[model samples]
Target: MCEAVEKDLYAVLGASPSDSVQQLKYRYQKLALECHPDRLGDVCDSEAESGRRKFLEIDAAWKILSQELQQAWPIDSIVSLEDMTWDHDECVYTYCCRCGGQFIFSEEELPWRQGNDDEKKRNESQHMVVCCDTCSLSIYVKLSFV
Candidate 1:
């Protein structure tokens, strides 16, 4: 099923479509705090409920905007051709290719994060240790599927 995209968040947050995720997040947080319900109550009793609703709206908008921003200005992901290797017999591979300390997988058929300890251990073992070949230092990697 197709999900409905929210078109009004830009106007609600007073942000341009091109605004970076960080920019959107900062703007939303600032606006949410400025229009907090409790703060609004002191100014106008009738506007308190309205302010609360807007706050919720902004929170929702922030969630979507942040995701979009991350996609646009993704953390540096660099893979070096020389450092990647494959173990065809085990259907496993390891890489020293990444510039930043992160790993990403493109296999859509595999189930990644859901499993028991034995499965976890098995998967961990399959992963070839990836590290900075230049520094020979291991960097922390964040995993995500696209």
Candidate 2:
């Protein structure tokens, strides 16, 4: 089975992780319509097979992206890494939540934190989900290493 982490869902959908859910949906739908096997009527065998594969890929991408969207939809806000305050003592980044709570971001949660030195050197940006310590609200923290 293909793991979600093994495949770049955003790349499959020709999207960026920073893209809004609505943007992702639009891109997915456009790609799906273009690659759908039914739209390849009367094509050669190879062409039809290729279309089927592309359609399946688009479908899988949508399924995964949609699931992620659903999971992140409840976030109270999106916070940029620079906007968060870093605590040298606690060694964690924090953002103030509206409910008098704090959204804590740790280094361990970073996507590129586990790889080799070369991997760590290649700058990339992505979002991490963090929940308020004192409330039900969560925030999407944008982490960048540019």
Among these predictions, the greatest lDDT belongs to 2
Alpha-carbon runs more than 4 Å astray in model 1: 1-6, 43-45, 77-146
lDDT (0 to 1) per candidate: 0.52, 0.75
Off by over 4 Å in 2: 1-5, 75-146
Give lDDT: candidate 2, residue 43. Answer: 91
Query: Quick one: RMSD of model 1?
Result: 14.4
lDDT of 2 at 71: 78
C-alpha TM-score for every candidate: 0.44, 0.49
Tens-digit per-residue lDDT, 1-146, candidate 1: 99987567788899987543434655786798887776775656567777888888888888877665544443333443234454565454345434543332222212332233355544543322123333333323333222
The ten-residue window of minimal lDDT in model 1 covers 105-114
Query: Each model's RMSD to truth, in Å?
Result: 14.4, 11.3
lDDT of 2 by residue, 39-124 (tens): 88899999999889988988998898888666754789888889999899999888998889887756644545534436433354
